[model samples]
Target: MIYFVYQILPHNCRSVRSILCSSLFLQKKGKKGAKAVEEEPVQVDAKDRIDFDSAKQKLQAVVDRFAKYANDAKLGKTSPKVFDNLMVQTDHGDQPYTSLAQTSIKGRNFIMTVYDPANIQRIINSVLGSGLNLNPVVDPSNKLTLKMPLPPITTELKNESVKELKNVYEKLRNGASLGKNHTLSSIRADARHKLTKNKKLDNLETEVWNEYEKLHKIYVSKLSEMIKAAETAIMK
Candidate 1:
């Protein structure tokens, strides 16, 4: 048996009809005891030709069904084995079962193993809490990768440290402003007040520096965790 494969395109119905009609000529033989007659090409009528429109509709239906199956597989709504069976059924047993098995396996792996929605949402929440912007990059193979902006807390802490440092410098520079200069004893008291202010400012600056370092370490650790999660999710 011969199988004829026809690819139909939009606005090419007339061309398809012509090609089909021209290729379907019927030959006639002479009487059994007599010599064979010369062959003549016969014209096939449009009504006698295969109904391409009906075939196109059937093929389109199959395509739509396959797409639905693929989507279901991706969403974890269908098992790989079930999806493979459906594909084979859609092709009316024409396609080999093993030919589509690998595709189904990949689809299952991507949906069930690689991109776990719950895990992804957890990662998203962590990123958001860290005040970082999450950016996803999808490659040509439909695999997802992530990019994140530096955590806002890091910048905020650094800015706060700079502001505290400036305040401490200003206070030290204007030590005399902390005391009144009314008399010698008052001037001595002013000196004592300046000393106390200087010590307070020094402690405040040290605290700000320590807080900045702690925040920087936290930002680095959270970013590393997010990167590891993204790699695990998309690099199967």
Candidate 2:
């Protein structure tokens, strides 16, 4: 009965004519029907093929994310046996638990049929955060290796320091001959050359001279006029 239905002619709505002509009835009439009732030329549904392709694409993306999201922490779950099994699904590091395992289907089929875009994104973020922030010592064997952040410089001090740095280098090179490299020892030695001279505003980089700028200015203002007047009296 079933074979007879498939052999019906396709000329009408049900192709009943062909079906009957190709079945047992046809054999009685001396025209042998085709051996097989199922035809290979059945038209496939466009939507189904599209749906499958789309599903496959989505599943692949999820599996790829799952692969990338592999890490060691996920494998070290409380259940050692489960860890042993799931660990094979991923590479190294703390691989996160995937929903695919919860599905009744096999792991590979879940990897193929599963579609979870948001979960994939979450897994990617998880992978990003899973990496350990390494803090290696500059010299591990030294037993005292440390890296400290430098203190921030004030704007005014930074500008002044920059200006003075050039003069400090030049003094170091040229003043080397006079033993005036501007170090504490060099400056103290130079100071001994004068008995009671005012601090000079010389090396721009040296803050010690800057410390005396105000006092030097005040003295020069108050004494410049009197010294000139006394000089005139002596000359006359």
Clashing pairs in 1: none
Error of 1 at 36 (Å): 4.1
lDDT of 2 by residue, 19-88 (tens): 3344565566553344445577955432222233333343344333322222211221111122122321
**TM-scores for all predictions:** 0.18, 0.16
Indicate which candidate wins on lDDT. 1
Whole-model lDDT, model 1 = 0.35
lDDT of 2: 0.32
Q: For residue 81, what is the lDDT in candidate 1?
A: 41
* Best candidate according to TM-score: 1
The lDDT of each candidate is: 0.35, 0.32
